[model samples]
Target chain A: MSLSPLGASRSLAAVFLPIKSGGLVDEVCRRIELAVETGLLTSGQRLPNEIELAGALGVSAVTTREALSQLRGQGLIRTVRGRSGGSFIADDALPSPERARARLLDLTRLQISDLGLHWRAIAATCAGVAARRSDAADIASLRGYIRPAAGDGQGATALAWRLSASEFMLEVAAVARSARLAREILRLQADMGTLTLLPFGDPAFCEHIAELSEAVTAAIESHDSGAAEARTRELIQTTTNWLLAEHAAGQAHTPGTTEEEAS
Target chain B: MNGNDAAPATAELRTLVEGIEGRIDDWAAATTRWLNDAGKLSGSAIDKFVRPTVSDMLLAPGSNVTGAGFIASAGLLGPDRSYIAWWQGEDLERVDALANFSPQSMSRYVGAEWFKVPVATRRPHVTGPYIDLLCTDEYVLTFTHPVFRGDAVAGIVGLDVTAQTLERRALPLLRRIGPRAALVSAGGRTIVCAAPDVDAGDVIGPAEGAAATPIGRSFTLLAAAAVA
Candidate 1:
């Protein structure tokens, strides 16, 4: 996902910062705490130090400090106590089907539709632009990200596919030459978080993800913007349709099960 | 005001960019001239063109050209579809980007903006101050012009010049504009900037402000204050 040699994450940091004014500290604390719950801050990832956080979030340093302490109290972030010490997400804050289902169940149909529109727009635009802007190295690097989770029968292949598919999504955005688009996709990925990845648990869905991965890379390599874009949208639409089906059958059956795929 | 100071530098960069454009268009025109009478095109047909020209373009005194050659249109080479006759590197080695060249593989070059834009416009086009990743392995500005067979485009003739070369050659001229001065693409992606926080390739937004002056068809010299 490296786009610029300098810093690509500044825009990512901007996405989490509250754009409107209100009860600033509570809002800052709530947004980040929700980000953690939704798996945006994965296990072991460190939150930026308070001052850095304050600047990026555009909140007061005191506000950032207070928020960090609140998160620590909630067992969301555990701070280390050494030279390298900073707030880190607790190891137990792993993404789970429970969290993903709960989050997905919380979202209304209109909300999911809104998210899909935004996701498809950014994803498709990235592919189209990447097709035009990519060079041989971009093509080579993108090709490397297309490997699907091995059929190891080890039972964690769902998470494995999720990790690789998510990385491929981000990589395509970075290659697009639009940092703005990359940052937006990163934001959407964060907002959708674990719920967006639930479909990867299904072997059929993972196959589709892998196919789209290969197709989009080929289209970009071939410099076919139209095909690259259409394949990207197809990738999202496949996932969206799966999620909508789950939304329709809420709590009726276990997710991450073949039944979800069957529905 | 600093506006007056930036004026001369803007004109200088315009000259520099235009010079690069002129060289690329000349190469493209030379290619079209050869194809007009060559009868049929093939790998050897293109090699003869390169053996006579690539060295002069890449190693000539003060030359910035790093890669130059023909990118053929799809299906122009029998089952081979399209192929690149591009030569690059310090020694000017010949490199062909196609591997399988299957109907599937041919899709790769046909859509490259370097080839696509000129075909669409029927005029010379400049693409990227982007990382080349393919040739020269540096930030590159690719200038491409179409080669025609009858009324249809048969191929493109492209020239690659590293952004570093342009920056190294343009920085002194750019500094006269002011500390925040930058050379940006037509789309406002910075090719070079004096601001410490802004690196090349970050879009500074559309260069329509009073601070911007057109450099070439593809670039602008802007005294932007904010680093986007």
Candidate 2:
């Protein structure tokens, strides 16, 4: 048996891929999930028949049927039975900032700080690696992602602006060449992206973020790992500091707290 | 350092360091099957057949497949070329935007390392420590493998894993090597540094007392026992 980390050897193919679990049904579910999560299968995009899908997967059609049922149960895919109908990615609702805010309010300042440290550690590592690993094409791509998104009075526009920064950061991770780092970044962004909004409608905050993006891109392009990592830390620290302050102030202003202030 | 003082810690380190390579190799091997699966379908079906598999694999409790999807060859999907299903998660929620349809031009992605490296190498390779837009909106290492149909290359398939997970899981193991021990990527990016003065993200160079050990094919964990 191959001395696989965390367990016994299972499959020849799994040796080259980091799989945390085993089974054909699990594999089928994994592939379908990869498609939807990657944006390959958009909301409402139809999937092929079970026989064809199973052929592509190199698994039996019965396995494909089971995977489809699992996906439907997870609400990731829905099947419509009729002419011109098949499995399609379920339409997910847009992320709610209120939900993000509530999540933030639930966390303590120390938890926020710990989370920030994790973010900085991941971002800094990526930036440092990216600075050394990137080539001309990499530099150009970084610059391309930095181009400013329009942010008028619209909420969607504001959200887009925030997502643009998040996307740029992920691009830096891609250049780092470590899949694990990229996944961590994904977790951080998913948890904090909505909460990291630029104090919506605050033009000054927007401008600062845009400038931060430019500075980061320039640092990565110059191959200055130190500067890239430092800048990334600055961004994370500033955001986390603001979040903690907001949480504290919100608590201080809670309804009954005014009575204590009067006393 | 006294012999008795250092012996047990050194032995414990050995046990923890033994099997990392096999694990990474295992994950990389599984992805080849995914690319092969994509090859069986038409280029248009790349997203439909090959993309969501990434999300499913990542669903495994400890699996680290971040963003998994296919990027079609330039001409296969026609002029406003199409590449879809690059699913990534920032937390538990799935966040992936279609490449060609976004308001901001993703035209640049075609030239990004994740796309260009696999196409150029025609072999399964790992590239990054760069931001991966399609997978995570943060630093990630993307393992990309080429998908072929017939004699020509059809597209590229990939998986992404973020650095934060590595640091969290691997740092403590390195710390056990010695009080000042640390783990760093092959590129010299510090994964975890035990010294109060040295921290993650610091681009550390060769050290006088450091002993470096390979942690899989991508990282090195260094331990330095300070002496008077």
Best by lDDT: 1
lDDT per residue for candidate 2 within B12-111, as digits (tens), equals 4444433333433454454445455544444446545544465566676776555566666666556555454455553433333333343123455666
Interface RMSD of 2: 8.8
* Model 2, global lDDT: 0.63
A75 Cα displacement, candidate 2 (Å): 7.1
lDDT of candidate 1 vs native? 0.73
lDDT at A3, model 2: 81
- The local lDDT score (0 to 100) that residue B109 gets in candidate 2 is 64
Name the docking class for model 2: incorrect
Q: In DockQ, how does model 1 score against the reference complex?
A: 0.02
Off by over 4 Å in 1: A1-263, B1-5, B97-103, B206-209
Q: For candidate 2 chain A, which ten residues in a row score worst on lDDT?
A: A147-156
Chain B TM-score for all candidates, comma-separated: 0.88, 0.69
TM (chain A) per model = 0.68, 0.61
Instruction: Give the per-residue lDDT digits (tens) of candidate 1, residues A53-153.
Output: 76545568998888888778878789998999988879886667777888898788889988998899989998998887676767876776676435432
